[model samples]
Target: MSLFTNSNVTCPNCEAVVNMPAVGSVNADRRPDFRDAILDDSFQVTTCPNCHEAFRLAPLFNYLDVGHGQWLAGLPASRVVDWPEVEDDIDSVFQASFGANVPAAARDVADLLTVRVCFGWPAIREKIYLKGVGLDDVTVEMMKMDLMRRLKDAPFVQGTELRVGAVDDQAFQMVWIDAETEDVRQRFSAQRALYDAITAKPEAWAALRDKLSDGPFVDMQKLFLGQGRVAAE
Candidate 1:
């Protein structure tokens, strides 16, 4: 079920309190629109009426994607009222919605189910964006590691950030932005040909299926690297 609650938010600029709608809870089956909003990267924005300022609102909510059989409980550090009972609460909510047949991805809530802890709006946005692009979060992290390795020899400024951008049939675009100015520094494309070729193998596909069944995020760096690599073998 989709749930929303109004909360009084004090404007950082004017200190004027305004009641705003915050997502109290949500599930994909019950509220696919909320999932759509996140996929569109539109859920992080909230505007203050009095100050007329737009700011990011991080609310505690359960993100359940039935289509993907994925469930995420997002808890930003700033809003934690009770830390002790979080596990029990999350289990209760999950059981209430999904009953006993929980997905293997979240079978062990303490270890694998919890995705974000003390994460900001951007973190949430990145997860949704990557998922939308049919990529695993851990795979993206490994990709980022590879990107950093490639960039180690390149000439760049001090506060530059590299992130995975648009994914296309041809390539995956990696965007480099200036951290201080938040300006696009460069856009580099990494050809998807190699990835496509590797995953085309039966072993690779089976490994991926097993990983996804285990959890939404999977570190496939080892699977694709070394003499013992799945692709090479």
Candidate 2:
């Protein structure tokens, strides 16, 4: 079930206090509109009644979409630096709910779900968008790595991310966005063949796949971040 709680929020524009309903967990299978809101980049947007300014809350919720076989923990981008600890925490939560610690029936459900952790809106939105388009996300991350090598002025930096904005038969529309402000700094498209070529040669990317999939936060950015959690042998 989807859960929301009314909380006090300070309007960043005017410093006015506003009471709003903040989401705790979203069950996209039951309320697909929530999923649409996320994809359209409108979820958790609130207008300050005092200053009439629009602001979006940082995502800090669990998202479940059984139909799409996804389960994600959407966290604030500021927490990216602490991803290793956060990953372990979310993993334990998943285990308690649907993994080995749970009943056999729940564990069966877990087998069909792809568990992930995403920082900020763009990261989570890109994940859902990729799933909708039937794209392999791990491959897409590998493609980004290749793009960084080819693009002379790629803006691959801290607090900036390369995310999939849209896709078509021929190409993938990509954007470089500020993780905190959700501002798009640049946009470009990569040939669909880039994704296909990588998918065709999985053995070549086997080591990379292992690193990206080592935790629920299966993003290539982790490679650039501080030393990530070491996987159990």
Candidate 3:
């Protein structure tokens, strides 16, 4: 049985209505979670290319999302899938379904989380500012604690201490630290929102500098200056 026989997809960015169908391979209901919903849909996945909003399975709204999930940035969004036309031609990774059979390189790609939004120059600049924090050994643990606390309310917040590298290093590496876990989507989403909020109002953000409490705002500066006590102090 299918979960969504007639579902609609709207661009989180353009708000454009997307017309697509969820064609499942196996059973959509038996698949467990929304993320798994698409995997079951051997033939269809809904996405908003304009904003990069993707619902691997139809009834994407049914996906286990906390709030303002991964696609909030709202641009350059799409979930590309590999479908096998021939029975024997199937890719082992997609066949495995649980990502257990993924090779080393592809496995690494799985750990990554992406966000896309068009905030224009100001938003972009704010993100750039946060990225300025250096991931030196001294503040690494603090960064971990900070990520943990901030994400405390966010269940399934990837339990790993994120590796936050320098700006140039961000492309292929996150330098801070690594605390891995299965739950992180929610925390990651929150971080992105916080980033957007701070970026939109830098002066107001600066005034609340003391409130960051390990959000990595002033902490980034501390990481840069080698000050270990607190980000504000």
Candidate 4:
């Protein structure tokens, strides 16, 4: 069932309060239109009536894709609390909704879904898009780190957004965007050999897997770097 509520929202542009749809939950298979809106980033956004300014209505929401057998709980990062418990609650919800058996690949509840402690909609949208392409977010970050290291002496600034645009068995294509300005810097390719190296290492895969149980913002770069540091020691 589709779950949402219309609430009064204050326009940041003109301060006129208006009612808008605050989506909290969605069963995508039943509500295909809602899923389309989410992927296109239109569901939580509303235009202000007084000033006609567009703004995001970022209430925490749960996205369940029945066809893909995936789910994501998106919460504001500021609401720091017991996330593992929150995940457990989501697990219970999933079981009640879908029954006891989950996919064999899903070894546990953490594997059953994704927990996104998001700063805003863009990050959440990107996560959804990445998963659609069968690329794990943690592994993609690892690739980004390798790209920066290879171009360490280049003129690029720090904090550029590394996004996977396409992937194949031989290579992964990425687009680099300036973090602050949100401008596309360039497009580049990262050898698939880099990705293979990480998945091949049991320790690295285990590091990412273990961190999934703790909380959100997996911090793949930090975890990957920590592994590298340990290896060098």
Off by over 4 Å in 4: 77-119, 145-193, 203-205, 212-233
lDDT of 1 by residue, 98-201 (tens): 55676755455423233422133434555666766776665455456555566654435444545566788888877665432335778788877645554456
The lDDT-based order of candidates, best leading, equals 2, 4, 1, 3
RMSD of each: 8.8, 1.4, 18.5, 6.5
If both were scored by lDDT, which would come out higher, candidate 2 or candidate 3?
A: 2
lDDT (C-alpha, whole model) for all candidates: 0.56, 0.91, 0.32, 0.62
Give the TM-score of each candidate: 0.60, 0.96, 0.20, 0.65
Candidate 2 lDDT by residue in tens digits, 1-233: 99999989999899999999999999999999999999999999999999999998889899999899999999999999899999999999888899766789888889989899999999999999898888878889999998888887877678999999999999999999999899998999999899889999999999999989888998988897987766669
lDDT of 3 by residue, 116-148 (tens): 221112122223223334222222323444455
Q: What are the runs in model 1 whose C-alpha is more than 4 Å off?
A: 77-118, 152-162, 175-188, 193-233
Among these predictions, the greatest lDDT belongs to: 2
1 or 4, which is superior by TM-score? Answer: 4
| Minimal lDDT window, size 10, model 1 | 221-230
State the RMSD for candidate 4.
6.5
Sorting all predicted structures by TM-score, with the top scorer first, yields 2, 4, 1, 3
After TM-score superposition, what is the CA distance of residue 166 in candidate 2 from its true location, in Å? 0.7
lDDT measured at residue 147 in model 4 versus the true structure, 0 to 100: 71
